[model samples]
Target: MGKMKRILYFRHDKIGDFVLAWPALAMLKRALPEASIEVFVTPVVASLAEACPYVDHIILDTGDDKAIRAQIAERNYDGIVMARSQVRTMFLVRGLGVPYVVAPKLHWYQYCYKHRVNIQMGEGEPVWRKGCRLTERLLRDNDIPIPSLPTQYWDLSAERPKWQAFYQKQADSQLVFVHAGTGGSSGSLPTSHFVSLIRQIHEQTEQPCQFVLTYSGEERKLAEEIHQALADTPVNVALAPPLDKLVDFAKSLVAADMFIAGSTGPLHLAGLHDVPTVGFYAARRSAVHVKWQTLSQAHKRLSFTPPPGRRDGRNMALVDVDLAASKVAAFLNQDQGK
Candidate 1:
C-alpha cells in the first residue's frame, strides 16, 4: 500500500495504436499523480509520447533484448501495465521480474501478468476504453480509486497560435483538410473521390473554402493525383508539409477547421484537437463506427460507411462521393451555425 515510485507501461505499436491509448495513459496520470509513469513505445510513435502529457517519461523500444533488460533493471519500476501486449514484451517483463504486472487476459501470455483483466476486442468496446479497463483493473486490485474517463488529450495550446498565425492568410476561408491515403491499414477512397469531395465542398459553400491534402512521403503520388484532378476547379489546393517528423505533422492539423480521413492516425489527431472531422470507414465490424470511432464530440464529427450488406473491403470506396460531400457540407454548415 506504500506510494509506488515508478511504473512501466507498454504501447509500442503504430501511430494509431498509441493515439487510441492516450486517454488511458491520461487516466493513469490523473489517478496517480505522484507515480512516475514511463511508457515504452516504438520509435515510430516516440514523438507522440513526447507530445503526450500523461507519462512522466518515454522509453524507446530499440528491439534489443539486452538493452531493454538493462534499461528496465536500472529503472526498478514498481508496477507495469501492458496496454498493447506482445509476446516479446511479456517475455521481457517476466525476465525482469517486475513485482506488479498487469495486462489484458485476452493475449496468449496472460499468465505473465500478476494482475490480468478480461478484455474483449470488438464493436462492444472501443480500443481506448479497453486500455482504460486494464488500468482500472490494476488500480482497483491495489485499492486505488479509479479516475473518470478521458474524452480527449492533446497539448496544442502552445502550437495552436503558431498555426493560427501561419494560416491567417486564409482566416476568412474555412480550412478543409483532407487525407487521401489510408496508410494501408483499411480501405481507402479512390483518388478521384477525394478530388470530387474537395470540389463539392467548394461548390456547396458560400464563402471561400481552402483545401489542403496531407499525405506520407510514400503517398506523394496519391496527393499529386488529387491535386491534378482539382486543377480545373477554383478551390485552392495545397499539399501538407513534409510529415517526416510526427510532432510537426501534429502541429499542422491544428490549423485546420475540418478534416476528412479514413480510419487512420490523422483522424485521431484531429479528434485530439477537437477539429470538426468526417471519417470514412469500411462496413466490416472491426472497421465500423463502434470500434474505430473518433473521440471528437458528436456535433463536431461525422462517420460514414456503406450500407449494411455492402460494408466490406473496398466497399468503403463505393461510398458515394456526392452523398459524402453533402454530409460534409451539412456538418461544416452546422459548425458555422448557419
Candidate 2:
C-alpha cells in the first residue's frame, strides 16, 4: 500500500449512529496520522461533525445523489470505509476508481468491495466495535498496526465552562437532564410513566437535583405536562431552554451529572462525556438494551427493558418505571455517598 493520504469515512446515518462511530474514526486517524480524514454525515448532524476533533473535514449529504457523486469525485479519495453503508452509498462510489474500498457484507454490492468485513450481521457486538472491526481490516490490509481507541475522545473543555457557570447558581444541586423525546427504535415511556419516575426519584434522592426537562418537536407538550404535574412537589424542576443547534445541545450534555432518556441519540452524546446515564430499552432483539446501551461505563449507566415474551419489546406500558426509578435513585444515592 503506497502511503494512502486521503480517506473518506462514511457514517451517513442518524445522530446516534454517527456518534457511536467516533472511536473507530479516531482509531483510523491514529493508525494513519498523516492521512486527512473526511466524514460523510447527514445535514441533521453536520454541526456535531464539525466539533469532532479526529476528522479534518466534513461532507454533508443533502440526499442529492448527483451532488453527492460530484462531491465524492471532487475529493479524489485514496480510500473509503463504509462504516454505515447504504445501498445508495454503495452505488454512488461503485465505479469511482477509488484505490481501496471496504464495507460490511450487507447488500449484493458485497461484490463491489475488495474487502468486506462481516459486521452488523451479528447481534451481540456493540455498534462502535463493528466500526472498529472495519478500521482493523483497513489497517491489516495496508500493513499498518491496529491501535487502541480512547475511552473518551472528544475534548469538551471549551464547551464545559458555559454549563459550569450556569450550574454554579445551583451549587448544591446535581444537574439531571431528562429528555422526553426519542428517535424511535421502539416506543418511549408515556407521560404518566415519566412523571411517576420523576416523582419517585425526587422522593428517594440522597441530594437535591435540578431536573431539566428536555424535548424535541411534538414532545414539547409531554415535557410541559411533566413539569405541570410536578408543580406542587418540593423538588426543583425546570424546562430546558431551547438550543438552536445540535452542537450546542451536545455541549450542554457534557455538563450533566446524570442523563435520562429512552434509547436515543442524546444518551449517546452523554455517553461521549461518560456522564452517568439511565435509559429505557425494548426487550426485542433489534432494540435490545445491550445493542443500544449508552457509551457510559457499566457501573455508571442503568438500563431498563420491558419484560421478555412474545411482543413484549413493543410493550412500553409493561416497563416497570416505579421499580426502575427506585433502583436508579439508589444508584444516584450510591454515587453521592462515594
Looking at model 2, residue 189 earns an lDDT score of 80
List ranges where model 1 is wrong by over 4 Å: 122-124, 167-169, 310-313
**TM-score, prediction 1:** 0.93
Cα lDDT listed for each candidate:
0.78, 0.83
Give the CA lDDT, 0 to 100, for residue 284 in model 1.
71
Model 1 Cα lDDT, one tens digit per residue, 75-134: 998788888787888777776757778888865678766688877775556667788888
TM-score of 2: 0.94
* Tens-digit per-residue lDDT, 199-224, candidate 2: 88988998887788887778789899
Worst 10 residues of 1 by lDDT: 307-316
Q: Highest lDDT: which candidate?
A: 2
lDDT, model 2, position 312: 73
Lowest lDDT block of 10, candidate 2: 164-173
